[model samples]
Target chain A: MDKNINVLIVDDYRTMLRIIRNLLKQLDFNNVDEATDGQEALAKLRAGNFGLVISDWNMAPMTGLDLLKEVRADARLKNLPFIMITAESKTENVVAAKQAGVSNYIVKPFNAETLKEKIEKVMVHA
Target chain B: MPDGAQAGPDEDRIEAAVRAVLVSMSGDLTAKEAALLAELEALGRTIARAKAEIAQLSVDDITGAHIPSATDELDAIVDHTAQATNEILDACETLEKLEAEVPPAAAEALQGAVTRIYEACSFQDITGQRISKVVSALKAIESRVEAAVANASGRPAPAPAAAAPVAPKTEGQELANGPQLPGGGTSQEEIDRLLASFD
Candidate 1:
């Protein structure tokens, strides 16, 4: 059996985290870990190896943007793929995420197909 | 005059005058009463319609889509109605105050107008209150959705692994402070400059 890919899902909402984890599992990424906010996620990142990061934009204490910035700043995790999920569909927000070096941006109310496509795109470039 | 004798023209003229006065008085009273009844009935219908509309509206509609515009329209309508109602009430009060000064015919006409104004104003007030409640409900729904979204996602999601090991802290140092900044006793100005550099 192929070893499962390690995916870290960061979001403030438990439901969204479960949903993302389920989606990743369907995509054959069975090794998924979750964090409640960016700060905790960063701590976990420092502790373990993760192949990809899926994060929500709006969160308390440390936002997804802050997490992305931190990840990009770290030499070890700089090359790791990152995907941002958010409710805000505005062009400016998308541009900002892209400029911050996000692999892809997914808007909220998305289906499994779209999530899969985004993941594929990020993995291909990575 | 004998008990069975026919009434003379003078007596008939006196009777006609009395009948005319009574008919005019009765007509005025009936018109006033009817106007009041009509106004009350209209007010009741308006309230009922407003209530029905309020019942049909979903909370999501108020908060999720075009909320500000909907609220603004509702506020405007309510304000217009309130102003109209106040004007009508003021007019009614004015009429009452001038009851002795104005001729009965003119006063009765003014009263009818005031009644109509009151009916219109009451309609607006009922509708406005219902819409305001709807707006409040919508706001509540919005907050709930936000909360649900927050709760569904794990508060702190995991991050990608860092490449290097953090330096070990001294026994007396706080573990929570991840890494010590170089030059232990940094000045406040230097700290501010460092923070500003991040921005």
Candidate 2:
């Protein structure tokens, strides 16, 4: 696995972005960019060829679910690995994300190891 | 046989009975209406009080409740604290990277300080999650208040149920719920099992 793979982290909280960035850094992933919401993430995704997307499920104007659906619709980004991190740990949410072609799901309050493991699980298998 | 006199009294009796029945019916209707108005007034007052609390959570220039923007403030506090913590950790990481160049005693002390800072930063995550709980509660209250106001006013509140988070108004996720407090929400293992069950 290339630890330097470019990963896009989308979240409304700047703190969460920083935390994810720092944790990625710990795991030797230094190449990361960010978006504050799904709309911004879409703009970024179209502009760059991201190896993976780590996004929050809930956001304004556009949501991670919206982003996932859009990504799946786009020919260029349809195959991109997407992981959703959210406090919405319900079965329906998981099912919805899966139906939208999400690669993985991480519940909130997760540690770096959990995140890393989830990411690697998808990245390796995908 | 005094038919004229007898008919007059019978007519009067019938007229009086009809009047009495109408008056009683009117009184009953008025009482019901008054009770309904009182209940509505009480509900309206309760909703107004809740609206005030929602305003305290976050309000616009007009003092109208804007729960999302209001909770955003609490979320921002957590964000800022976490960002500062990240900066501290960045410094710690830098120091650790240069640990070989520093004296053993100095390195140990610096490492200890970094450890403490890192641990302290963990508080930011918990704090942010806790704030999420407060926001969720506010949203629930906001929704109920909105529903009451809408019911009373005969107008739909702007996505009243949207006070709960994670999903939007249109086609809200049937199962998605808001952030959980400590000891709340589904565990990762449960999520994993649920996801696997689909397979």
Candidate 3:
């Protein structure tokens, strides 16, 4: 896994985005971008070459699940590594994300170590 | 009194008495029927008036004023928490940068504290998602009240507001419930096991 890979973090909340970005920095991944919602994140993913997507499950207009479906359907973006970082730990949520081809999942209140581990797993498998 | 006609006084008195009883009973029944009709009419009016009052209950107050006010407050709460969380993160980041300059022991301590701060700041995300769920619930209630008001007024419910969040179109979409309350959700270890099953 290249530490310099460009990571895109999607969350409607600013604090979460900042936290994730800071954690990614600690993991020595310096190149990071932020989107407040799934639509904006989708636009960014299409326009730029993001190596990874870390998205929140609950967002308005287009939810993370919706965005994942769109990504999986798209030919170009289907192979991109996607990780769901969300508070939605329901069994169905995990199944839906997995069915949508999410590379990893992280429940909220997670520490930097968890994030690092999940990212490493996905990136390695990607 | 006529030849071959035996008309007795006792028979005549009895027949007269029966006639009087029948007349009295007829009068009482008519009066009771009148009273019953009046009571029914009064009940009908009460029901009609109650419906009118319920219809006149300001739809604007419930669907417009109160619901929005509640959601706005929740939104403000999310905003305030996000702001506070960012402040905490800023402090943590600064502390992290300074850790490298300090001695190894102090640096290790600073790094540990910073990591804890990051973990704690996750409260904002969890709380924000929970607040979003609350806002969605309020909107759902608003829709129900709007429908009830429309029904009371004998009008069709207006189309949902354009700004309303779109309904989930698929079973997968419907499963995206936000953060669950404590003791109500799947644990991370459980999720890991579930994902393993998928493989």
- Which residue window of length 10 is worst by lDDT in model 2 chain B? B1-10
Alpha carbon lDDT of residue A121, candidate 2? 87
Give each model a TM-score: 0.40, 0.61, 0.76
- Per TM-score, the best of the predicted structures is 3
Docking class for candidate 3 = medium
Residue-level lDDT tens digits of model 2 in B1-199: 1211212234435445544554455434577776755554454444444444443432232225466668878878876877777687678778768766899998768656654454455556556656777877877866665554444344555663335555435322334355665566668898878777767
Off by over 4 Å in 2: B1-176, B181-184
lDDT comparison, 1 vs 2, better candidate: 2
True contacts kept of each: 0.00, 0.29, 0.73
Ranking by DockQ: 3, 2, 1
- Whichever of 1 and 2 has more TM-score, that candidate is 2
- Tens-digit lDDT string for candidate 3 (A25-45): 878899999998788999999
Q: lDDT tens digits, residues B11-119, model 1? A: 3354455445444543345776767555544544444444344334453454466676766777787777666655655565566567568898987676556444433
Please identify model 1 stretches exceeding 4 Å from their true place.
Answer: A1-3, B1-199
Greater DockQ among 1 and 3 belongs to 3
TM-score preference between candidates 2 and 3, better one: 3
Measured by DockQ, the strongest candidate is: 3
Residue B175 CA error for candidate 2 (Å)?
Answer: 5.9
**Residue A54 displacement (Å), model 1:** 0.2
Q: Give residue B50's lDDT in candidate 3 (0 to 100).
A: 51
The digit string of per-residue lDDT tens for model 3 on B85-167 reads 88888788889989879999999888888887888889988887788888989998888777766765677778865787756
Name the TM-score of candidate 2: 0.61
True contacts kept of 2: 0.29
